[model samples]
Target chain A: MILQLIDIGYLVAVVLFILGIKLMSHPESARKGNSIALAGMILAIVVSFFTPGLNNIALILTAIALGTVGGLYSAKTVQMTAMPQLVSFFNGMGGAAAALIGLVEYGDLPVDDIGKGSVLMASLVIGSVSFSGSLVAMGKLQGVIKDIRVNKILAFLVLGLAIALAVYVLLSGQPKPLLVYGLVALALIYGLLFVYPIGGADMPVVISLLNSLTGVTAATTGLLYDNKVMLMGGILVGSAGLLLTLLMAKAMNRSVSNILFTSFGTAAGPAGSGQDGD
Target chain B: MDAIINYISVNQQEFYIFILAVFVGIEVISKVPTVLHTPLMSGSNALSGVVIVGSIIVLGKTDPANYLALTLGFLAVLLATLNVVGGFAVTNRMLEMFKKKPGKK
Candidate 1:
């Protein structure tokens, strides 16, 4: 019966999450939205303690503290202009967390359930890349990296290496845990290399992409853990993230690839050049 | 006693932290000027993208009992997307409106 607390808490958390997002639709209600989300997270973490096999209260507390400090510092210190970048950073952290969780689970379960294995591996790779890509995008937005453009050769090299690594992993019958780890590292670096050259004005779109990646990572983690709720939650996040990214692109009248590759809005042309007669 | 202490600590600490974070978020929102309303709304609306993935999962689950949940999730994603896109369009129009000269027309 004690286990029921977790379910109830999860239900409450999901409700709050939904309400929070809804309230966030308007500027006036955004404050409440933030509160609702905070409450949901609290409920989730607390309920997790009651779950069997999750007795590591100290570890969980430490993680929460670390994340809280990071979030608080970002909230306080980040300039309004950098809010989009900060959002990307948060999305990256969420993806990385989910990816790491899946990786750990895969390590624990050495038996090769091919379906779970493939999904977890894909999630880890995509999540790692998303995290690094988000950081690179953030760096560009903050002017920490020099404004540059993606060359065709570099693009081809990144794509080629990523594909080659995936094929190598698939064909190799060995339990290449180390290889998977290496791919994660390489993917992160590739993301950094891939996103850094992109212009600052694309931060909003990049942020949305990272958000989608986080959702995918979460879903993958859920799969690895064989948790239905996690899978459902992750899918919710991932799809929403992708749709938002698409919507943002449309708002700017740019394609997703264009946002990634083309240097749009770096140097402002005449302020109202695109303006049409109303 | 130790368990009691742990429970108390978790509840007290988490509760306070949640309250503080909520206040901080609210303060941040209250400080923004009217000119930033559109951009801020659009930006936050983008956060609702989480709904899309959530709905897809529910819909894909193939459970008849969850039909309502799936439908609601999908609607939430749709509405959220519209809010983000429409917010941006309105902001852009407002910007252009400000840029025009009255006598020149």
Candidate 2:
């Protein structure tokens, strides 16, 4: 009976999420949509209490309280111009949460469950990459960090190394937790190098993509635990958000060179044209 | 190749869910006007905070004695919470600004 209720509750939350995204497409009903989605988030939290084996209740509740206070305060106080940075910073937190989930769960996985291992490896790498990458993107947006030249060749090599490490861990028939460690670290470095050189004007594009990546990372967790709310929410953000953004960019004929160069700023849209104060 | 197929065959429901989800995502978001992209992006960020559910699971299941896992899981809960709260709050703020003005069209 309890399981059935949990399932029903999650399905309701999924419907709310879809409604929320659909409503957000237009300016008129967007706020209502956001509220609906917020309700879904709250409902999901409430039902999570029904999940078995929940421990350290005090710690979990305290963390949620502290985080809520901090989030509310910052959201209320931040200026509009820095909205991108705030979004980037908050997105990084999401990534960190996903990566930390993989970290905490990694030790408990059976030594050779290849399927679970594959999912965990994915969440770990993408989450770590998005975590560090968002930080760099935020820093670049705030002009706290200078744009250093990046070599595409080197970036590709690091990505290759990270992928290779992940494959070895998942397929070696022997769990190498140490290599898993290397995989996370390498992905972080790759994220740094990958986003470090993109001009500030191009950040919205990159941020949207990273946001999509974070969503996919989140979905992998849902896949890991077979949770409908998590899986639906994550996949919705991952696929819908990304496809829409890419189609728009394509609509405007945004190209690879545009992503790597600042010239897209003058022509792309408000995000690029107005953002870079440089 | 067989191993890949074996994994998919065993987890066929998940694959179906994933594919159906991609289609749903694509369909729901296909028509957002460019003016609303920022709100949509930020609002979607809030949606991504649904990962909070995942963090809750990890924290709840983690043993209290394992300081490493417990601490990480605690941080995950905290971070995901902030993402949910802050993402929605900020999106609301932006949408308000974009809301129709009294005198303007």
Candidate 1 structure, TM-score to reference: 0.66
lDDT of 1 by residue, B23-63 (tens): 33333344444333334333333332232222223223323
Candidate 2, B1-105: lDDT as tens digits: 466677778988888889898899889888887877878888898888888898998999988799988898999999999999999999999888886563421
Name the lDDT value of residue A67 in candidate 2: 92
In model 2, pairs of residues that clash are none
Clashing pairs in 1: A235-B53, A235-B54, A236-B53, A236-B54, A239-B53, A240-B49, A240-B52, A240-B53, A241-B49
lDDT (C-alpha, whole model) for all candidates: 0.52, 0.85
For residues A1-278, could you state the per-residue lDDT of candidate 2 as single tens digits? Answer: 98899889999999999999999987678899999999998999989878877888889899899999999989999999999898988898999899999988888888577788888889998898889998998998999976767777898899899999888877788767788888889999988988887777667777888888888888999988988788888888999768755864665466544565443223445665423323
Off by over 4 Å in 1: A152-160, A163-173, A263-278, B1-105
How many clashing pairs per prediction, in order?
Answer: 9, 0
Every model's DockQ, to 2 decimals?
0.03, 0.75
